[model samples]
Target: MSTALPQSTGVIAEYRARLAAGSIVFDSAQASAAERLQALWAKLRGYDPHPKAPPNGWVGRLLRRKQVDDVSDHPNGLYLVGDVGRGKSMLMDLFFEAADVPRKKRIHFHEFMQDAHRRFHAIKRDNPGINDPIPALADLIAEDAALLCFDEFQVHDIVDAMILGRLFEALFARLVVVVATSNTLPDDLYKGKPGRDAFLPFIGFLKQNLDVLVLDAARDYRRERLHGLNAWYVPADTRADAAMDHVFTTLAAGAPAQPGSLMVSGRKLAVPLSVPGAARFDFAALCGTALGPGDYLALATHYQTLLIDGIPRLSPDNFDEARRFVTLIDALYEHRVKLYASAAALPDDLYKSGEGAAIFERTASRLEEMQSDAYLQLPHLT
Candidate 1:
């Protein structure tokens, strides 16, 4: 009988060290994010599926060459849902960053929707000959990676509600495994909006393709840390220079909120300047304008933090305006933006009118997201 040669312990130790340090760049060409993800899948597939079991210990399985699932067939498509600050996003980030996949793309859900909307319009205007953009989009995704991850998956805007089908169809067509974390269940997204019933098909598609898992521990991780007065809302104490100084100092430490109007596809936003440490944005005028998802998307890309005041009422015109406001805040939050807001009342109490209760629900959810410990940890002043 042929005997296997003894493995060198020194070499094995070196290999482990290299892997831990991320110095073992698996053949860049071969061990792509997609491939790395497949490696993880291979490792996972070999493990016992039972609730209680030890790690995989089969030598034969280890010796055999494993097949990584194509983008479409990867077995671990995931849907993680829970209340804010319950570590949903942190878990997603860990999975996306550590899991080996041949090609991997982790997109903030809001940003992705904004991007999809932007591309759809661009394609429509530029290539009118193409009846549908889904096919081309699918091909592009297929070429890039076999895995995709999204953080804070949500659907609120008319634009998002309209394109859910085409976007998912393209992504799913490529056979890419999707991992998404959301505050809302897939079925409950955009629940109360007008014509929301139309989105059922997309929800059905998600349910069929993804394994939904809920991490519903009631404890709000965000609120636990914010229990005391230390984190409560506090406006800048000093007037004029102190306020502006605090704003500038706070903003400069994080992403610089450059004083410039943002433009998206010919739309212009006139940004007001702060004297030294204060913001110049006219909240009334900004909210009063024709606000929509597009406007928020533009602001999100440019500013990581926003402070808005003077919200008298949260009516439909106000709700629609605030919807964009919420979308912008969501987008910024997805990008890890710091937000500080002051209104006549708290978000939950902002709009308590007839038939407009839905806006309050959305507002409460957004406020929770903003107050999450992860968000709070970002540089901010009260």
Candidate 2:
């Protein structure tokens, strides 16, 4: 499906209009990338839909023409890499919305893999003796979506790592275009996995098929918008609770909050409330249980901002919870994940007397720093 370009205007012009209207902040690097993506979108508009054909004769020739049209006319897909909160996801959202392709889909990478695994199971169940499933699965996906946009592209599961090279090779062979955003570059993907050497060929394939662009703007645009906003609320009350809810709604762009879960070390960590880029939890749900740094790190990696509710003051009676809170704070701080919380008291007064009171001083200091403009502007760890 083709959409008429708004008169002669392009995506760059639309973006500039947003800047002029104060709807978005202007960033030169991001604007340049958007211009390039607009060019790619125009090239994609040239190709017709994939043709249907029998094995041989005139129909077969039409199939060959389809391949040539795509491979020769379409530019390489994009691999957009940048620091967290640098507007990579936001820019890609704009590109996806503006592209007027009927056979296109944009999804989070984790959700995509989950769907792929489900497809694998269904294919195996239906065709018990199939020698190879990846090609068939790729064909099915290409039939549905000629263009695939993936957000937060990451690989942690060995099962996923092993299958991606073959699966993506099949997709590309069938002329499926893929655009992805990630905090890590193509070369650094799956770094330090137990058998990382086996994943190298996929990296090579990605480099050959996608034009890697870095959006290395110095400012963290999300943080800039959040400058001077209150992050910590003491004496948790109805007003503080309402403020937390407002912040979550604002950052999530009005997406409805729902329960979210994270799979860490084969266990599900429950989240009480979540939208696309942020999550909220109760203190008991997080620190009251036996969670460690690994769990916290997983949360930090997935959510750009976290909101914790009902943090009671720390004392000797709740020493274990205090320790857990310390670990959680450390993990969040190290990853530069933004924190919003309602507590019984301020950070310095939270743990007046506890087993780890001395060490808690540093935690207190970090908590204060996390609320500052300078610390909020730091890029998140990928």
State the C-alpha lDDT per candidate: 0.56, 0.81
Model 1, span 117-234: residue lDDT tens: 7767777788989898865565455556566787778777777887887678656654556788777898888899987878888888788777777766445544443343121133
The digit string of per-residue lDDT tens for model 2 on 96-194 reads 876657788898787688778889878988999988889678778888887899888988779899989988877776777888998889999999997
Flag regions of model 1 displaced more than 4 Å.
Answer: 1-72, 230-382
In model 2, what is the error at residue 180, expressed in angstroms?
1.1
Against the true structure, candidate 1 reaches a TM-score of: 0.51
